[model samples]
Each structure stands twice: as C-alpha cells, then as structure tokens.
Target: AVTALRLISPSTALRNLGAATGIAGFIVASLILIFYAIVAGWMIAFCLSSVANLLGMSDFAAWLTSFGLWRNILFMLIFITFTIGIISAGVKDGIERWSARLMPALLITLFLLVAYVLTLDGASEGLKVFLLPDFERALSPKLIIAALGAAFFSLSLGVGTMLIYGSYISDDENLPVVGGLVTLVDISIAVLAGFLVLPAMYVALHNGVEIFTPTGALISEDTLIFTVLPELFATMGTAGIVVSFTFFFLMGIAALTSSISMLEVPVAYVIEEHGLKRKTAVSAIGGIIAVASSTILLNFENLFGLVVAFTTRYSQPVLGFMFCIYAGWVWHRDTLLQELRKGNPDVEQGLFWKIWPWYVKLVCPVIILGIFAQSLWG
Candidate 1:
C-alpha cells in the first residue's frame, strides 16, 4: 500500500517498476475497465427495466428490444455518462463521499428486502439451500480454481487499487488494524447479501417463478435477477413497488462505485504523470471508454466473450502473479521495509515486519503463480 502511494504520485506504479511491465499492466487494466463498464451498463439497463415494471409498463423491455442493439447502446451511454460525472469530481468529494453514504444505504435497503422475503412462505427453505454447502462441488478442482480467481477479483488484490488507496489514507491510521477491519466488514456484507438474495430467490420459487429449467439447470442468471425478481415483486402492489425501486437503485449505486474506481486508475495516471488537469484526464479517458464500449456493444456475441475470457483467464491472473513477484523479488528489500514501517516505528520491530516481506517475496509469488496455472489448465 505504502509503495503504491509513493509510486502513484506523478509516476504510475507499473511505470515506476519499468516500462515493459508498466505498459503491459496498463493495457490489461485499461481493457478490463472497458469490459467492466459495458457489463455494468447491464445493471443500469436492468434498473430501467425494473422501474418500468413498477410503473405498470408491460411492454417496456419487449418494445425496447425492438430497436435491437441500439437499445443496449443507449443504456451503456447513460451508464458511462453517469460514471464519468461521479469520478470526474475526483476522489474525496466524489468516490469517498458516495462510498460512505451509499454503502450504508445499500446495507439498510438489503436488510429491508431480506426482512420482507423472510415473511414469505419458502424463505427458510431458500436459506437452507444457501447455507448448506455441496461439499463435492465445493472441493472440485474447477470450483476451487474459480474460487481463487474470485478472491483476487473481489479484494482487488494485485490490481493497484490498494496502492492507489494507500496514497489517500492518512499517516496516523494503523494500516494493519484498518486493513483487517475492512476485510471483516467486506466478508460480513457478502454473507448478509447472500442471506438477502437467496431467501428472496426461494420466495420467488415458491411463488412459482422459474429460476431453473426442467433439466434442473439454472436458467439465465441475468433473467432471474433483473427481469423475474422485479416482475415478481411488482405483483404485491404498493409496498412491493417501493421495494422494486429501492432494489434496482441499490444495484445501480453498486455498479457506480465499481465503475468509479476502474475509471480512476488511468485518470489518476494521466493527471499525475502527465500533469494534465483532473477534468481533462477524466474527459479524455471517458471518451476512450465510451468508444470502446460502443464497439463491444456492436459486436456483443464474439467480441464480448473474447474480452471476458482474455481478461479473466489470461490478463488478470498474470498481472496478479507479476505484481506479487515484483513486490517480493524485484523491488528493493530496504525500500519495501521503509514503506511498511512508515508512520509506525513498532512495525519495524514486530513479527510482521520480520516475517511478512520475506513471505511475500518467497511464498506469495509462488502461490499466485500456481493459481495462474490453475486458472489456465485446471
């Protein structure tokens, strides 16, 4: 974290490492950001569709689809514009403020939805299915590999997010303590969200809304959430209408937060490294993403699948592996020690300082490399 902050100043972190690695990481991160924006556009699109259901617009989706790909392009454009507006405000007034406010509201809204679902007939049954793990599937090589990838993606590990965030954190803050708390809070939210969504899924199932096909395979995951759930909730009249609106609004906010962070990376690089104004940096990058998203929207089938496969299976894991390796091996040991010990003298004398850097050097890189292998071949 400290290294990233120190590096993210006027110099990009990857650039600080070296040009070849820096350019490679930058390309991967940029491509991922582009794909992410388009995927998130679906959330905004669904929010629109969900709201239409609440407002008694029966033919909204069908009618929208009549325009073919142009319909999706419209939502993507709106999503990109909305994200650019938030991120262009820069970090404190924009990203940090929205995160602080919307995260709590999102939690409260989730809990409220969970409470309503609990009142339904099959809520308990849904909870049971979610809580009970299928050990065989869980232990499968494919699932294990996927879970590892998910862990990296969820935490944004090796993604330079921590490095960027490190630059913003105050000197007096206890890094270890704060990092631990964040992990705990993130885990709690994930579990709570599962409790909320799974029970609602069960309730929908009980109401005879189909989530699975006759062959017992899950149906279109997107169809289940964005389309069916809102449609099901809309049946309950006024209170359900409120819930539908809140649910989609909550989803939109979540997508906004993620988009903000992704857009920030390159924007920050341009602003700091090239000495461009923040607004200029944001507008320039936003145009690039908007154009990239439009191209993907036009070729949604082959291009979309190719982007997803390359980023997830190839680029992300490889970058993550390279990051761990660089932090462990390539970066000077004393520099790393200094970064870790900043603002906390005790850290220098502690077991963490004694053990962690070497562990990161020796252990972490190997593990990440193994995971990269698994992601490809396992």
Candidate 2:
C-alpha cells in the first residue's frame, strides 16, 4: 500500500506522466509538420516552375481556373478519413502494423518507378537538376529558414504531441536517441521525395514546358499531380500508369501517416481531459474531420484559393515557438532534469542539467519570441 501510494502520488508518476506526455506530443506534432511541408513544398516548387510549361499552358492562371477546387476538397477528405481510421484501430494494430505493410509497399513501388523514370530520354537532365543543387537558388536565408522550419515541424520536435506520446512510454527508454532516430527517418523521406519530383520535372520541362514561376514554386495542389504529373507521365506511354500509381500511392502514404498523427493529438486531448473511451473519442474526432473535409470538397476552388492566399505561411516557426514556451516555461527544469536522468547514472550530465535551467528560462524564450517577431516583420 505504501509503495502503491508513493507511485501514484501527485509528484511522482502523475507528474512524470504529464512531462512524458508533453514530450511525446511535441515529437509527433513536429514530425508531421516537417514531412508534410517538405513534400508539399517541393511539389509546389516544381509544378509552378517547370511542369506547367511542359503542358503548353499559355496562361497558367487560366489553366488553374479550369482545374476546379472540388478535386482538392476530395483529397483532403480522403486524407482525413484514412488518418482517423488508422488511429481508431489502436496504435499497435493500426499504426505500427499498417505502416509496416504500407511502408514496404510504398518503398518498393517508388524504387520501381524511379528505375523506369531513369530510362527516359531526359533522364540525364532530370538527374542533374535533382542531384546537383543550384547553390545560388538554394543559398537564400529565406530558403534556409524555410528548410529549418520544415525540418523541425516535420520531425515533430517541438510539438506537445511528442510529449503526450512520451507519457505512455516507460522511463528507461532514452528520449534523445529515440528523438534523433525519428528525425533521421523523417528527413530521409523528405530527401527521397525530392528525388521523385525533380526527376519528373526534368522530363516534363524537356519538352519546352515552363511549369514553375520565375521567382519560386507555386501551384494549385489539385492540378499538381493529377493534371501536371499525368501529362508528364503520358509522355512515358504505357509505363506512365504504373509510375502514376506508384507516385500517388507514395503520396497517399505520406499524407496518411501525417494525418493520423494530427488526429491522435485531439484524440489524446479528449481522452486525458474528458475521461472518454479512446475508441469513442477517435470516432468522434474522425467524424468531425471527415465532415470538414467534405465541405472543402464542396468548394474546392475557394479551398485552393484560400490555401494559396495564405500559402507561403509556414507552420514550423509558429509551432516551435509554442513548444519552447511549453518545455521551457510551463514545465519546470528540475522536474525535466530528474526525468531525463532517471536511467543515466554514470554519465556526466552537469553541463546540460545546469545550463538547461537558464536555457529554458531565458534562451529558449528569447529565441522563440524572436522568431515570432521576425516572422511578423518579415
């Protein structure tokens, strides 16, 4: 009874659990943000600059008007449905299990498609554009900032989502190592996506196509893969269908993974606060998102217009600022240190432990606040 009481005490398990939850939430949310932003950004960049020209559109804006918005709305709906369904299945059964299967399939398909694209007439040019970065184009501070934000956001580093997931984890696991591993995986996928799209752009542009804008990447997401890529793939003849399926399938998987994580956040909130059954909460949230997605489909043009209107707006810096505050301010440093050092008795942890108090108390706040200010001003 004494041991149980001690374990369940307000300051021990409950406190640790709360900290862990916050860590998990941060990781998950940031990762989703990072992956989504990178893939979508790369796609936007390519379609706007190169692919549109290949399609022989005299006026890109006119082409966009003809594409309709409902297609995008349908995509958002599918994305939400697939995501919520996975969470509803339970993590072990849904996330890990389904991903284990789908991830392999996605990779295999991507490899096959890449091989085929490599055999195309413009393959050399495609390889050059993607592999050799244009230092001048990529050297901008804005691009660097965007990349960093995309990295942090996609990796789920700063979000409460990671912390929440961490709450469910045992104390013995090393948070830093696990965090690093997830980040690596997230980045690897983003790079792989670049390989996929840049090659396609090279081929499409080889035919005198001018898809992208002069200054930077831009596009209607609805027309992106469906309109743009399809035209490029058509140049591949019968092989295009196979390539198209693989490309869409890969995209679907990425979207699915990110969407599931998003759904998990609200679901976690409901379960922790309302004491509702996890299954019920998942279903309720899923239903709500599904409805929202459907509405988006009903007015696809407005959805696209709105998304584009607010397009360049990035989520990483915003979310990162929130995270720095949560981890550095709302949560106490001593509590965090004790939680961090639970299993590492031999390691010299003084520098980190000692510096963290000030880091969290002063540095993190200043950095995060500065980002917000810069973003507002920039």
Instruction: Output the number of the lDDT-best candidate.
Output: 1
Winning candidate number (TM-score): 1
* Deviating ranges (above 4 Å) for candidate 1: 1-17, 61-67, 222-224, 227-231, 234-240, 349-351
Instruction: Give the per-residue lDDT of model 1 (tens digit) for 243-276.
Output: 7667777777776766777777777767766899
RMSD of 2: 7.8
| Clash count per candidate | 0, 50
RMSD in angstroms between candidate 1 and the native structure over all alpha carbons? 3.6
Predicted candidate 2 versus true structure: per-residue lDDT over 140-182, tens digit per residue: 7666654655555465445455655566567887666666687
Question: Residue 15 lDDT in model 1?
Answer: 48
The C-alpha RMSD of each candidate to the native structure, in angstroms, is: 3.6, 7.8
| Residues forming the 10-long window of minimal summed lDDT in candidate 2 | 1-10
Instruction: Report the lDDT of model 2 for residue 145.
Output: 57
- Model 1, position 64, has a per-residue lDDT of 42
